[model samples]
Target: DEYLERESFETSYFSTVAAAQEALDKHTAASAARDNQSVTGSSAFSEHWDILIIHMVTSKLDSHTMRDWETERNHIKSIPTLEEFNSFLKNRADLLETMEEAQSQKHTRRHSDISHNRPKTFVLIPTTRINCEALNIPSHIKLADPTFSVPAEVHMLLGADLFWAVLSNNRINLGKNKPTLVETTLGWIVSGSIQVPYSKHNKMQSYNTVHCHFLNNIELEEKLDKFFEFESVSTTQQSRTKGESECEQIFTQTTTRHPDGNFIVTIPLKESPECLGDSSQQALIQFKSLERKFNRNSEFKQKYTDFLEEYQTLGHMSENTNPQDDKTSYIMPHHGILREDKLTTKLRTVFNASSITSSGKSFNDIQYIGPTVQDDLLSILIRFRQHKYVVSSDIEKMYRQIYVKEEQRSLQQIYWRSDPSEPIKLYKLNRVAYGTASAPYLATRCLMQLGQECTDKNVGETILHDFYVDDYISGNDDEQTLIQTCQNSPTEFMGEKC
Candidate 1:
């Protein structure tokens, strides 16, 4: 009985051990099957799993959580001590200082180089007209209108004056040397026309005629010759001074330069006709022809339409509420005050009341003065209500509306120099100019003061208005109410209305 009981116990123990081993093997097989499934899913999925496993393994090895732990480990590894750290910090500070010094030196050198470069200058010449007539006469001149006659001599003098004015003006420095004369040839293609001033004898004699001919150099001639083929020269006669048969001649200059360039005389006609008829009619014809050409050019029309669409889109974008999608509008302020004294005093009073300072200086200490409380009043009024219909009015030159006071004129001094070598000269602002940091603030304050005054009067409710410098947008439910507000406002300088 004892032997049989011992055998039974041993058999039970072996069976239990075998069962445990089988369970362990099954778990291992399941894990391997799941991993194989994951690997076979997709290339991307397999790569991601590999990365995740790598990160998990890395995290377990040496987790650096705190500065003290890092320091302790460094110490164990015989890393730099406190004394070495302090030396390194000092060296780093020195390196930073050196870098800053180097940067400053580089900036100074660049600035010096820029300053040494010669300043550029440009010259502009007013265009003039030259008449081709009063020489010899030829037959078969194509006349547009019988009533019109070309002026022969007056235009040449005008052209000469223009040319001389451009040459003599020393304000424009054309590099180290002036432009040398290349070649001066008469441009026979009539550029533009002007109405001749009436003589004392008859007011009816005034008529439109070709005023000038463009004169170009050899460079321009070569450029013209590449494209244009010479056409022909023809002329006609016109009666000039009284009984003596004066022959007014004209050179019929034509070119096949479809890609237009500066005018060149193809067939030089010695004698031409003064009676080239009405230059206005010829100009109209040319304009019509141009219009037709422009209409025919599909690319140009498409581009123009595209440009207009873009412009409209931009305009709409600017008017929209979304700041990110909108275009920025620039404000340009005019200079000079229409009523300097009154405006200055009004602005000063507003500034004093608000206790506003600019650039860490009191209003009195500030050099430039602008609208103080008026802008705020305006902004509040316009923004008070949103309307379906909005119309904006602009004061032609608002800054001029403010009059500078005689007493305050001396305090409103601004100094500036175009060049470093030049002395800073004080400039008295006669008008309101933008770009002063304090100007907007002052203007807003002034608007606020104005609003208060209006509120006290109980004339009308302040409307919603937005101002970006000079540009103001006023929105109102009633157009008539807006008009009335503008009309009732006392300040009408520079034609600013409600």
Candidate 2:
């Protein structure tokens, strides 16, 4: 509400105007009552004089004061009044009507100007997946068995009609239940209900339902005809044997290549050859198939390993920095130390010490500088001589956990500047956060407070842990002690088995 008051001038002006109008009415009424039953010409003059005085005083006042007067005048005018008061209201209404007429004219003119300035027409181009598919040639394709040569031609003609229907209305009905070929194929592929054939020869080219539909589509054939003028036809000969019939060679001319470079090829074979007789032959074929599958798997694994090695090597080389700067450097405090008298009183009492750590002493105090300082400190401390077997733990989403103090919330607000047309907005911090320079110091202070509590409780005698934001590394002499310390800490490590 406070922010709303700041942004809207009309709201403030309306409130002030209302109050001023109320005050004027009260003054008018009091003056009229004082001059009651008096027929002197001075009575009318006195009333007008009082009204004029009120208006003058209100006009000279600040916006809030003027609004208060307006509010008072409006309140008093609501009551049954003298003839002269009614006449005054009628005149004021006429003035308001004139102002409103002028405002309405201005608004209409502005609206007309805006409407004329806007774009006359806009074309919305298709970009989404569904819209793109609607405009695509592949979506109109249909597939059939490659060996069915006679039916394939018939299918092509039917597919052309279906494609036209889809293009006209963006949908079609094939029968009582079946819809367009594109819809059926999309349903199968998207739902993962169709079994797609995996090809080891070409990973990029696999026989899926989508590919099957695309290949048989009439629109795709038309596109190929336009671009490539494909031609030529060829056939392969295959021999087949049947029961009680001597093994006879059949010269089957099965493949046909279209004029647009698109081909319709066929291979003569039983749908499931293993379903035939001869158990020993089927076993031998199965073993050979397994061997081929193993070979393909091994080849894929080797290629993947080579790719990983190259990727890691390139990543490391890119990140390689000068050794000297990588080493941690100690930083001195920027501000002067607390005075000896203040420190003796505050620190000595707080720490319950016989003597406070003296100021300006290099051994007693130090600070870490730079963005990577915390990471460096954690690494060095984990490897320190006094402790070993460090187990690192992290508070899940720690920045979102800590609450901001109510009084200091505004101090944490960030003003975000967007486009020029939109005003800058303030984002109030609802929780502790990163990215701000002061957040790290604030988080560290919170951790210190928690540490002080733990020390007071005297829990986990041999364990030593230090926290930096969400991350914590607890060190002990052995693995068991470190594990125990982690169990005692109030945190869930990544919500997994800790």
Candidate 3:
């Protein structure tokens, strides 16, 4: 009810500029009428102020002030009233004034002899994992990051100026198997590695890299050129491995076109899928964990549920109606990935085909990871730069356009439910799943096959050579030819419009 009320207020009053202006006028008139009443003070006006406009006030505040506002607001259990916000600001103003007066009375000092040899930018040290528990440092000391045993990529680096400022003169050594503790304003940072007894299985390897460049060395350039030349596709006809050859042969033998013009391809299995044991239990556990996340975030839950519904609406997935034996069918766990940088798709549902089943073999482990069938990125980019007018576009839902064979669909089953209290439903992916190892190869191979059947020779050649996976990147010197190439070659492949 609260959610609906908030949505109604926002939609009615703030959906357009005219509506917002009318709301402002109404509020202004209400304030004026309230002032004329028998109420005694300014508290009457604040108490009557609309709480929805509080965000507008906070948005204009400085970072520190906004953080303080949030801290105070979080302590309130229910929706904070307008009067409470006004009272918070008043108290914040008084506190700032007191701090300013106290700071004004303090003496200022300057340092003259700080070292100039300090680095302008800090670089990461690719250090081995440091064991914090083995150090066994004093109880009074606090580590900067408590879970240092788990490796983490560094997000922020302190420069030389801040580095020296934070450093303290205190240090402690806790013998051979333990690391030393260095004191800093942030916390005590554990330094160095621990030693263990000699064993073949307990060996640690450390690697160091040093970079050197000779700018005007002719010999170096010639050697580098020769090395790249030897590795080039034009110079070397790379031999195919046994697995890759088998995978290609299977794809050729099993691929078929539906009457509707959709290309259906079998899952390239190196081993039988029967080896995979029942994975429904594992998938159920993962589904319950996903439900816990949904319980905390209603907005995220709505978006995720909407995505699944759309997938089903597009015929990418369908509920399994038949009772298939557990030995032949495989269940896949799924998770959501959130990419804030994306403009359209902020959340993506990805199925985990590599999850280990009860038989210790995953669907991916039994299937052959087909060899790369598309042009490399560097080659595509090089060819892309040669044209006078460049154009690039990628296929929408490229993998989903191609259908997996009906026999192979059992290997891609998933368990899902909108709510935790609801009975779990079984569904099978109808199209090629994105996370499967053979998906990229199968999708690209189909495009190559389409290119082979094109009636226009020039358009046919462009489709063959210009594509990198599903992306068509190419151009011609003439604008008309470039536009014509894009129009004729890229539309209606495998029953899908580009």
Candidate 4:
């Protein structure tokens, strides 16, 4: 009895395993059948698919179908599942098929009525022809295209499906290796090849080939040629102007270094400072306008006052005592500029040297802008990517760090007042003032001059080439090399007093 019970248990286990295997096979077969049915039915529901898959599939749909899909999508108010999309598509297909069937039946009935009512006759029309006199061909032959002899782009070619329909049973073969002329519904066509002929002078005769070019095509080619010229690799040096050369010479001759390692660069003037007229009236007008704005917005007024105070506190500007009313002394009008994106110092005062003075000439009009002295941003970025270790930092108050000549300080004077009730006073900037035409040249030239004095050649070269305006961006393949280079510079070469 115990043996029978054990055998019975063993039989039950084998049956359970067999049944499970069979169930698994059936489940897999059902899944495959459902997928196949969904594909075949066109409108049948499918399993849910990823939203990205749906987007890709929908992009391939025709305009009318996409419109319907959009309407369904709007009704759903969210991204539709693959099953829902399939159901919607199925309904659209059914409606379209029904309409097509109705249209086909209507057309068939109309055609039947016309066939019964109209006369049974056929009309043969002659093909279009052109004068082949320019080609000097036989008068009996007709040319299909008037400009066939002229070199032009072929718009279309007759495919195999239309070959027999256009071709006729007529053809004329001139001779061996000569082209054959075939008659067709499109008129006569020339096919095959011909041999080149020699002139009486024992040289290959030149074929009179005329090329037809449209105006737009000519314009397109001209534009393409210009694009190619701009894109072509060139290694020519940029030519410097006489004014630029003079500006460079002035910077080299006059630029000096202070005891604190700060550079003193003279303003590169294109015209004599005496050319400038009194700008006191313009400065006063601008001050009054700024006062009106300050009175309206308390927050803006506070920021503006703070900026000027900081500028003065940093010794970047000083009160101009015993100010002269002469051509050499021009007062610049300044306004506050707000930069919301800046984390600190969101507001700053911008001195407008371009403001027109009494003589109808601005200070900027008489100043040499000087040549761009720094490497372009593209070059800086490309070189930045070359190193395993990279570092980026910008000088603090770059322009303010450089000192301007004492005589030129009068030229950089500005009108300022803390409040509307207070009298506006003249203050002269002690550094390379921003917004002046020569400011960029002065600041950049000072940096280059400082770089020339560096003890390390590599550090000097990096400062000369890697710096774009105030920012320093450079790297080295070796980490230790980059560390050493950074350590050697920053304090003396860039970041500090220099």
Task: State the weakest 10-residue window (summed lDDT) of model 3.
Answer: 98-107
Against the true structure, candidate 4 reaches a TM-score of 0.54
lDDT of 3: 0.68
Q: What is the per-residue lDDT of model 2 for residues 341-426, given as tens digits with 9 covering 90 to 100?
A: 66222111011011112222221112111121132342334344346576666665454445543332332232222222465333
lDDT of each: 0.31, 0.33, 0.68, 0.66
Each candidate: RMSD: 45.1, 41.9, 31.5, 28.9
Highest lDDT scorer = 3
Q: What is the TM-score of each candidate against the true structure?
A: 0.20, 0.21, 0.53, 0.54
Candidate 4, residues 145-199, lDDT tens digits: the string is 5445433443332323355467778878756645566777767766544344465
Query: Which structure is stronger by TM-score: 1 or 4?
Result: 4
Residue pairs in clash, model 3: none
Q: Write candidate 3's Cα lDDT for 1-498 as tens digits.
A: 543453344334322433333344344334434433434344655554445346556665655456656767666666765556655554444222221111222223431222212212234333445454555777887777565555444433333455556768898988864556777777777665556434488874433321111123556546655665565333111334789889999989999987778789998999988788878889989988999999887878888999899889999999987845433798899989778899988999999999999999999998888887666666567667666799998888889988999888989988878877888899989999988888888988888887777676666666777889888898877999877766755754323431
Give the per-residue Cα lDDT of candidate 3 at 123: 42
Winning candidate number (TM-score):
4
Ranking by lDDT: 3, 4, 2, 1
Cα lDDT tens digits for candidate 1, 301-395? 34433532442353211222222331211111111112336733211111121122222232222222322322243323434334545656544
Count of residue pairs whose backbone atoms collide, per candidate: 42, 33, 0, 0
Which segments of model 1 are wrong by more than 4 Å? 1-385, 403-408, 411-427, 430-433, 455-470, 482-498
